[model samples]
Structures are given as structure tokens and as C-alpha cells.
Target: MTEPRFHGPDFAALEASDPEIAGIVLDELDRQRGGLQLIASENLTSPAGLAAQGSVLTNKYAEGYPGARYYGGCEVVDRAETIAIERAKALFGADHVNVQPHSGASANLAVYAAFAQPGDSVLAMSLPHGGHLTHGATVNFSGRWFTAVPYHVRKDTELIDYDEVRELALVHRPRIIVAGATAYSRELDFAAFRAIADEVGAILWVDAAHFIGLVAGKAIPSPVPYADVVSATTHKVLRGPRGGMLMCRAEHARAVDKAVFPFGQGGPMMHTIAAKAVAFGEAQTESYARYAAQVVANARTLSTSLVDAGMRAVSGGTDTHLILFDLQHLRIDGRTAEARCAAAGITLNKNAIPFDPAPPAVASGIRVGSAAVTTQGFDAEDMNAVGSLVARAVRAEAGTADGDRELAAVKDEVTTLVARKPAYPVI
Candidate 1:
């Protein structure tokens, strides 16, 4: 458990003996092991997943699906990918599974390629209204290829308005209807979205990248049954390798496979896929279901605690694993809050709230999430304490003279909180 600069060999020795890459890698590993990662899209993979990811399987190049690969030495990689695909299908209850895309955005792009051509219409959540870049942000490749028609939440409610979505569907009649979000709080109404898609002759594609682990735990409804295809990242709540997968009906299996293989990428990352299989297998257990439920409960507790601390949370609270706190309500800047929080040993991201008054980089809100802390074994009560410390820090910065002193106290509180919760247990 000794740090690199301590017990580990010198950088020059590693660079010469292994590769210059070894030095870069070990440095990153040191940073990750020491820092607090609160980003909602990130997680600590299990030991089994990590071991697979760091295995010699990475040396293999598996060009196709199991048993039908173009490569000569793909026998073991075939098993790894086949296991990953099967576990994904079983966990989500889908007829087909393709565990090849390198990232969530890639998975989404494959979905678009399978269903729509360039300039075809797509109904997706608005970016400012809790949408992802791939969902149709003008700067993204998805928007570059397709004309994106977006739906937003009610201005007053700060949550998705199904009535508005239905109206948009009626007017646009898009080729695909996407249901999922990056920042929105309340649970999505997948059934309502399915109905809208049916009326408009559109295919329902659910991107449950953020909440797949929750669905496995039964904390939320799974979209596999309601959608034509589902795309997700295995790393988030699923706690796997940094990769993506596609699940869909049997009819689209061939198209999905082609889209992910020859269409989206070349030889798959067999090592990561091997790691994903381990992660998916872990998700199939009773313990992982309990872990998934703990993620949501911790999120709610964090959201409620922030509200009590006088910060305005989007949709008033959270039903999933993330919460957006409006820092402007406390007369603070999201950028400043982010920097101060990190200095205080608390970690999270600065995110744009629905209809945020500020720009993207310097948003009006900070998003705090529970997935990482929950993985570290912090539960609801721990989140309550964490939330109060955040409120105190924000309020302190808003004041004069004594503010910096109070920030010190907040830092100590965070140190104590982590001491009680601790980081991930060593393998």
C-alpha cells in the first residue's frame, strides 16, 4: 500500500525498464488513490474488475463477436466478450447485448447510426434541461449528423414535462425518441415516453448510463422492456471497466452488432470487456443490489441536507444518484464553490442547472452526487453531515473576516467525515 514516490522504484528506472508509459501510468494511479472523486459518471471498480482490466488479455486483439472472429488468437477474448454480453443481457433483461463501444457517447452514436441517417430527426432531452452532449448538443457529433428536436421540463417545476414532450413529438414526429438525463432529479417516466414514441412512429432509445446499477438493484424501473434499444456505460453505477454496451430486441440484434463493430469501432478492448464481465457478474449478486439501493438513498439524503443548508436544489430534491444545487441562491459562484470545496477535501462537479443564468464552464450551480461515497461505504447519515459542511463553506465564503476561518473548520469536518467513512477498502 506504499505510495509510488515512497516504496516504489524511481520514474527513470520504470521508464527505461518498462516503458515511458509506465511512469505516466503509476503517477495517475497515485493521484486517483489519494484524491476524492465525486463525479457522478465515475466509480471505483471492484478488485476483480481491476485485475481483469490490468491483465495480459489487453495484448489480444479480438476483431469480432465470439466464435466468429477474424483474428487467429481470440479464443480467450471470445470467452471474455461472450460473458460480458450475456451478463449484460441477463442483468437488464434484453434479447441482445453488444459490449463493444469504448464509451457511452460511442454507444449512443451506434444507436443513432442503426436507426437514423444524416439530417434525420431525433427527439432528445435538452442539454440545459438535463441532456447529454451526445443527446443533441449542437457541438456534438450526434447533432452534426442529425437534426435534434429537444424536449424540456416545465419552467416552474424544473422537471421533465411529459405534456410538453408529447406536444413536441406530435409536431416533430422524429425518427427516435431518447429518454434519460445527466442532471435532472426526479425519476423519468419511461412509459410516457414509450407512449409518445408509439404515437409518432418513433423508436424509444433509453440511455440508462447513469442508473443501470440502480435498475439492477430494483431501486428504479428498468427501461429494457419499454425501449427498442438501450445504451449505457459500464463504469458509472455498474462499477465496471470504462466501457459501453448496447442492449436491444432480437430483431435489431444484427444491426446493433454491425453498428457497434464495423460502424463505430475496430478491434474491441478485450481487457476492458473482460473487466466489464467481472463487474456485471458482481452486479448480479444480492450484495450489489443492496449497494445500488444505498446509492439512491445517499443521494436523497445529500439533496435534502443541501436544501436544509439553504441551497436551492433542482426539482427540490433527487430520486437518483445526483443533485444540482443552485449556488446563486446563496449568492455564490459555482466555480468558486467548486474550487473551495476541493480545497476543503470535498469533491464534486460544477454543473449547469435547468435554465441556468450562467455559462457552461462558470455555471450557476454545483452538482453533488453520492455514487462514489456510497461505494466508499458512506450512507445517508454520512451524507447529512457532508451536506451541512458544504452549506457552511458556502455561507462562510459569502461573508467577511471570519469566513476563511470557518472554511478551515469545514475542512476539518470533511477530514473527520472521511475518517469515519474511510476510502475503499484495500483488496
Candidate 2:
């Protein structure tokens, strides 16, 4: 008989080699199992995605695109990437797709490089007002290398004022206009953005990182029809491995692909691309549409419950899977609320509300998401209970004796509720 073939490094072997890391991984798994994950940008990947991400493809180094790699042994990875590119094109109805970006930020940077020269003016949403860091934050490359002009939501209505967007574009005359948000709960007006960009002769770029999955499932309108280029992360509501993708008109395909390869990053991560293929295929199924619809419904239910518990939800309610609440009325800050909720086995992030008075570290808002919990099978009734728990925890004092008791009590309830549902039942 032939000698037994060596497959790959198994977790069992890893435990023997490095027990410390193995133990930490197990601890993290347990923590995820026992707590409520409400982070708006997080979701559990499917088993197929996980397996693909950890496959033998990780050992390969394909330095270039599928057919024109700088290294050898790329034939198999080339096929995997071709599948990913084709599926992304079908899913988004785009003329071209680039699957080499490492993250959403990288994708945005590539788009900027493709369309605008260094120091050219670019307009995007304000970071404190729901925009992402890559969208012209002062410390980011997009801000440093370009003339970054930011717009904000109206303080009175807590919504994007399209008229103001047009005015800003007319005044600034930016080379590119970016329309997307990280914390805003309303649906974006992509057509309006396109019109404004046209008035200014600017390229409209939509970073739909948070809602690509919803668009794929037809739960929300797509930006592909209006945007000149669109960038998105695969890991959020898309529920894929951690990676990024770019879709654009066929005319700009060469520039975008070149920017991602030689300009923004080195070799593409083939393993992640394979995982993305798995996710894109999964998104084409009927069940994903149901999941997407349920995510939106869960968000609305959670926002309503929070309002019922006397907390003020930003924009009154959500039209997406995210809910941003102003913590000012609760007599607490975002940092305190985040800590208290975490103490009670709930995980979320502090955010800045429109016209927030406090600093970023101690902002006057808390943002919660329903995607992860919905993935774990949470529905409207469960969201009501979660909202109650959040309210109670935020209302509790951090350093007081009674506060400790209230937090402990809420933690017990959260543990009991979450224990009933597993995020990955088959795992």
C-alpha cells in the first residue's frame, strides 16, 4: 500500500503544537455562543465559506489576475477567481467586477485612484454623521491624498438633505461623489445622488458595504444602476468571508482592476475569493431572500421596541438592519451604554448621532444591528425582549451597588434566551 498522504494542518494538530492559541479560539467560540451579538457590521459565515477560507488555496501565491499571473501553479486559483467574478457580475448586474480588494477601504481607494488624481476634490458623507472612515475621514488616505469635502444630515430631521447634497456638489465641484453610510438607517436615494453627480459632472461612487446582501436578495434597491463604480465588503450582511469587491461600468474596468492589483495591493487572497464565490452562490438561493426580508423586519421591530421603552431611535425608526439610538434622553453616554450592555451579555458599538455634543469616545448614541441575532434565528418577539434588556442595562448605574444587581439580572436573562438558539446549528 502507498504511504498515507499528508492533507493539511488540522485543528487537532494545532492544539498539540500550540495549545495556547487553540484554547483562545475555543474561548472565543464559547463567548459567541453565550452572548448576543448586535454589532451592525458583523455576521456569522456559512460552513462552506469557513471551509473554503481554511482550504489549501491559502498556501498559493497568485500575484496577478486569473489568466495573467506572475507566479506558477495559478490554474486552479484562476478558475476559482473566475467563478467569483462571474457570480458577482450576475448578482449585481454589473458590467465588470474586481474581486482582489482586501477590504472595503482598499476597494474605495482603488476607485479613487481609477477616477480621480491625487488632490482632486472628492465629496462624501461626514464620518460623525454615519459615513465610514474611508469616506473622507481626516486621518484616512482618502482624506490625506485628496481634497475631501464632507456633507452631513440635517440636524432637525436626522436625514440626508438631497437639496443640500446638490448645493454642495455645485459649490465644491468635486471630481467624485460618494454616496453610502455606515450608521444611517434609511434607504439611500441612489438616483438622486446620480442626478447630483451629473449636475456637477462628477463620477458617482456608492460604497454599499453594509447593504450589498440586501440588494442581492432584492430586499433593497441596487446602486449598480446609478453608480459609476460600487465597492462593498463581503462579510457584513453578505455573510461571507472577510474580503472586498468592486463593480464598475465596462469602460472603467481596466483602471479599477489595475488599481486593485499593482496600485492598492499585491497578491490577491485566493482562499477568500473562493469563500466569496461560495457566498455569492448562496445569495442566489431563495432562502437568502427570506433571511434578508427578516433582517429588515427585525430591525424595525427592535427600533420600535426601543422607542417604546422610552429611548429615542435616530430617524424615528429604521428601514434597514441597523438602528441608531440617541442615548442623550436616557441620561447616559454611548460609552456607558455600550459597557453596560456588554456586561449584560449584549455586544454593540457606540456611535455619534447627528449634532452630537460629545466626543467620539463618549458619543451620545448607541448603534445596534439585527443581522447577527437574526442569523441566530431571532424574530420580532425576541427583539422586543432584547430592547427591554438594553434599556434596563443602559439605565443602570455603572459603579453603584444597585447597578451591579440589575446588570447581573439582565445578564442571566440574556444567557437563558441566547442559549436556546445556536448561530450555526449544524456546527
RMSD of each: 4.2, 1.8
* lDDT value, residue 338 of candidate 2: 96
Q: Write the residue-wise lDDT of candidate 2 on 1-427 in tens digits.
A: 9976866557898799999999998888888888899999999999899989998899899998988999998999999999999999999899999998999888998998899998999999999999998888888888888898889898888899888889989999999999999999999999999999999999999999999989998989999999999999999999999999999999999999999989989999999999999999999999999999999999999999989999999988998999999989767999999999999998999999988999999999999999899889998889999989988998988789999999999999999989888677665
Per-residue C-alpha lDDT of model 1 across residues 297-410, encoded as one tens digit per residue: 998888888888788888888888888888886777888888777766667788888888899899989887788788888877788888888877766763455877787778
lDDT of 2: 0.92
Best by lDDT: 2
TM-scores for all candidates: the values are 0.92, 0.97
As for model 2, its CA RMSD to the true structure in angstroms is 1.8
After superposition, candidate 2 runs with Cα above 4 Å error:
1-9
lDDT for residue 205 in candidate 1, whole number 0-100? 97
* Counted clashes in each candidate structure: 0, 0
Q: 109 in model 1: Cα distance from truth in Å?
A: 0.8
